[model samples]
Target: MSMWSFILLLISVQCVFGTSSDADETLSVMEDDSVTLHADVSAIKREDQILWRFGPENSRIAEIYKQNMPTYDINERFVDRLEMSIQTGSLTIKNIGIQHSGLYKVTIISNGGTSEKRFRVIVCARLPIPNITRDSSQCSSSSYCSLLCSVVNVSAVTLSWYKGNSLLSSISVSDLSISLSLPLEVEYQENNIYSCVINNPITNQTTHLNITQLCQPCADTTRCGSAEAVIRLVVSVVVGVATVAVLVDHFRSVSDTSPLVP
Candidate 1:
């Protein structure tokens, strides 16, 4: 093989062995939020410059130059979402979304030579509050009660049910969805506790459920007695009113017959 081709082959072998000469950092940001990627160019001089690229294919995203004529140019892919600092050569993304998440590579020109800094960006959407509702149709007072955990506007989120620290059931969804749900059933008891949790890497929400509150039986005997007493009182009042009406009708009929004789 030619010298240049042999050199290229050696570089490929090193990459396959996970020894690529690129320096990279990992960054995680929440969706619709802003994050700053530090370049550590504190010693950057007026003669130095910086070039920022994104994605696996290294698409041009932004450029900062302090050479003969200082200027900043951001590509159309980022549009109004990118900002560059002249002093530190740091870049910030504003209101980032999923499409803006990926590998970001920057090439910096210094007195030593051209070096690179890579950032693996992860963008997560904030999780919504999960609804922990009792499934009334499936619950039984003598046994267990079923509860459903659900959320809307979910992306890259996991919904789970936990009894203390032990996980009972979980569902992970990476794609965006209008609704996601998971169900769990547990025996009814006064001290039983269950929690429904939904989370991403950055944020989470949890709601608790208690079996006693959700799976209670019908009205107790105490309330039943009061209900029966009210029914009896209403019946007695109706019968008394009927008896008075009958006596009034009989008196009127007798008076009508005697009036003709008088």
Candidate 2:
């Protein structure tokens, strides 16, 4: 064979051998607050080595392993947070933020050949806590109070209004701010509590809102009388103490001057 044909044959043989061991190996990732990647190469050749790379395009190397040995070279953003176990072929990343979402590549190499697999890592955003506030003046006997539901830290969300355990209404929008006005259809008394729930599908996060009825003027005559009495008693005690002090001083002065005559 010519020299070029000989080289081509060698390359084709290597490619075939490289993919032969990949049939039994598998890789998967589970994500929560962090990411856990499990790679099983136990069925592959015993002398094979594993390498891990991570990035948007999988152009950077995050870690490497060979024969139960490991060489970690992670980016600056994942210095102390990224970890790998060579024996298990597992990678655990802590505090997985939005920036960490991307593609990851794992390469297995042996003296005979090499094979590669790719996994996608997805990092979710934390959901915002919903704030519910009511406007009392806007509410009348004909109209129920207006409750505002606001969320921070997220731009898009779905807001749901719940009365007790039942869902009242749901509104979805790209903006973070939303409000729902309750209608005075029934005998809605003061101190009624409502809830607003926000959901973010991307991050799989849900938050709740607690809404309370607006404050009203108290109309209990007995309680108001008792409060007034207490205030009067306090003022009387203060005045009585001042008067006694003045009388005692006057008496002391008179007694001190009249004592010589006695």
lDDT for every model? Answer: 0.72, 0.55
Q: Which segments of candidate 1 are over 4 A away from where they belong?
A: 1-23, 67-77, 175-178, 210-213, 218-262
- Scored against the true structure, residue 254 in model 2 reaches a CA lDDT of 93
Q: Write the per-residue lDDT of candidate 2 for residues 133-227, one digit (tens) a residue.
A: 55544554343445565565443356677766787777665432234323222233544445667654443333343323342322456777899
Off by over 4 Å in 2: 1-32, 43-46, 111-113, 141-143, 173-187, 190-193, 202-262
Spell out the clash pairs found in candidate 2. none
lDDT tens string, model 1, 59-173? 7777777643324445665778888886777889998876676678878997778988887666665667888777766644346667788898765567899988898889876
TM-score to true structure, per model: 0.66, 0.56
Alpha-carbon deviation at 185 in model 1, angstroms: 2.4
Most TM-score-accurate candidate: 1
Give candidate 2's TM-score: 0.56
